[model samples]
Each structure stands twice: as structure tokens, then as C-alpha cells.
Target: MSGPGTAAALWSALGSLPLAHLVPTGLGPWGDGMARLMLQPLDLLLLVALVLLAVQNGRSWSDRLALVLPLSWLVGGLGGLLVGRELHLALLCAALVTAVGVLAALEPALRLGKRFLRGGTAALSLLFGLVAGSSLAGHGGALQALLGEAVAIAVVTALLLMALDPPHPRWLALGLRLIGSWIAASGLLMLGWLSRQPL
Candidate 1:
């Protein structure tokens, strides 16, 4: 074929590519736009840390405060959506993960006071919720996505808490601490990478 004809054919082939198939329709059995509500690795890690922190002190308030975390997140997320503001949730979450993970890792060696720990947990919970919520602004069907995300977060957190209820064996506790350290490390890495990106 002549050069121009070959170019035309190539353009047509490219145009015919099933680009729609590569994009998420977000129409799974769950619901339209539900995919954005799915829990991410960072979300799970944060929830795990929250649960561990809640059970760390074995106090009623700690458990109750842990429950508040998801509510706070939902409020923040919805608020962000309403205001149409973009929040740097990933950066905030990464920071929180690192801080919480470090504390968890150190819990074995350095004992934190109950009052101080509870206060910190409460503060962090609210912040996490707000930041995480704000970050959901771009998701489809804002209201539905926010509710679904909140529910999914709550369910996952509850399950983690139930499964890892403490009075954990020494080995298990150590394992959790190690996990915390790993989370912190991951957060640090993410933060570094984000820092280098064009704003």
C-alpha cells in the first residue's frame, strides 16, 4: 500500500481498538461506581493498625474510639465531596500509617501511657477519616461511593478486630509489631515518591 493509505489504515485500526473494554464500567453486580468504593491496601493496613491500637490498651474507650475512626472518615469524605475540594488523602494517610506503625512497633519495648495513647488514637482516627474522605471527591456517584466506602471500611475493620482480639501470644504480638514497622516503611517510601512528583 502507498504510505498515505498505510497511515490511514493504521489510524483506523487504532481507532477500532476496544478502548472501552480497558476502562472500568463500574457496573459490577455490586452497583454502578462501586469499584471506587473498594478497599485499597493502604486502607486495610490503616484499619489493621487502628484495630491493633484499639486492642492495645484493652480499655473500653479505645475500642469505642476505634469505631469512631470510620465515622470520621465518612464525614470527611462526604464533606470533601460536597465542597468539591481535592484533598491529599494519600499523603495524609501515608503519614498516619507511618506514625501509627512506628508506635505499634515500639509498643513492645517502650510502653505508652493509656491516657496518652487513647488521646493520640482519637486524634489520628478523626484525621484519617477526614483526609481519607476528602480524597474520594473524584469517584463516581459521590454519595453512593462515599456510603459504600464507609461501609466497606467499617466491615473490614470490624473483622480485623474480631479476628485479632488481643491477649495475643508473644509471637503474634511481635508479628504485629513487625507488620507495623513494615507499614511505616511503606508509608515513608510513598511519601518520598509523592514528594518528587509535579504538584
Candidate 2:
């Protein structure tokens, strides 16, 4: 199955497509709205693909966390969609959570300052919570901000998660590598598509 982190990234990327419509300039030839719709399902597909990769990588406790992280990510994104929170705020929360979990699980391997990591996370979480809460008091810009944040965080998180050498089944590792390769390829494809259409 796909890890939760990867699934979240896929959904966030798919969600980003809709945001393109909100842009005043639109997407040029791709601006009429069809391109956004066309690219939407690719997000879900990517999520599924990631899960498959995770399964192929291996079955372990850490791998399960990898799976759950994506789910947490999905919950956070869905929260923004349902409750109207800024996308960036959601992403900050998600990243914070994922970072904490990763740090905690890999503590044996990581030699960095545990205090700094925990404190920094707590501070960022609190700050983001306040921003999201305050923004909620005003208007509907939450989705826009949150979705934008999602795009950036999800993309970055995907890379980060892929970078780690989480112990797992041999097949699973192979699967993860394959997934990583695909994620890289997908990034290139997206860049090419975005650049060709004009800003």
C-alpha cells in the first residue's frame, strides 16, 4: 500500500490544479479550464502509485508510519477544504507532524539536537495554529493559501521522504526506488507542462 505521506503529496498536487483557475491571468492556451480538470486525476493516480511503491519496498513499523504520514497529510488537507484553513497553515502543520514523527522514529540514526528539533516544531506549530485561527475569523482566503502551501510542502516532503533509507523488505526498497524515480519524472513532466503554457 502507499504510504500516507506520498498519498498526501498526490492529493495536494491534484488540488493545486484547481488553484490555477483562481489565478487572474489563467494558463494561456491551457487557461480555458480544461487543462486543470485534465490534470486533476493524475493526483489520485500518483497517490495509488506511491502506495504500491511502499508495499513493494517492504513491510515494517517504520514503513507503516510512512503510510500513516500520508493519511495524516490527507486529513490535514481535507480539514483545510472542509473547515476553511489556509493551505500553508495546513502544510506547516503536516510538515511539523511528519518531521516530528520522522525524527522520533529515526532518533537512533539522527545525531542532531533533539531539543532544538522539538522546540522548533512546537513553536512553528503554535505560530501556524494562530495564523490559521485568525485567518478563519476573517474570510475565505484559507483554501487559496492552504492549497498553495500544500503544493510546496507536499513536493518537498516527497523528496525528503524518498531521501531516507528506511529499512524494509528488499522488494519494498526496490519499489520505493522505483517510486522515487517516478516522482522525479513526474516533477519534470509537471515543470515542462507548466513552463510551456506561459506564466
Task: Highest lDDT: give the candidate number.
Answer: 1
TM, every model: 0.72, 0.31
The residue-by-residue lDDT of candidate 1 on 39-156, one tens digit each, is 3566667767767766665646445754676677677666666655555567777788888888877775667777776667656656655554555454444455556666766776
Off by over 4 Å in 2: 1-39, 62-70, 82-180
lDDT of 2 by residue, 87-156 (tens): 4333333333334333333343444353443344334423443443333322333344444433433443
Candidate 1: residue 104 lDDT (0-100): 77
Give residue 78's error in model 1 in angstroms: 2.6
Q: Candidate 1 — what's its lDDT?
A: 0.63
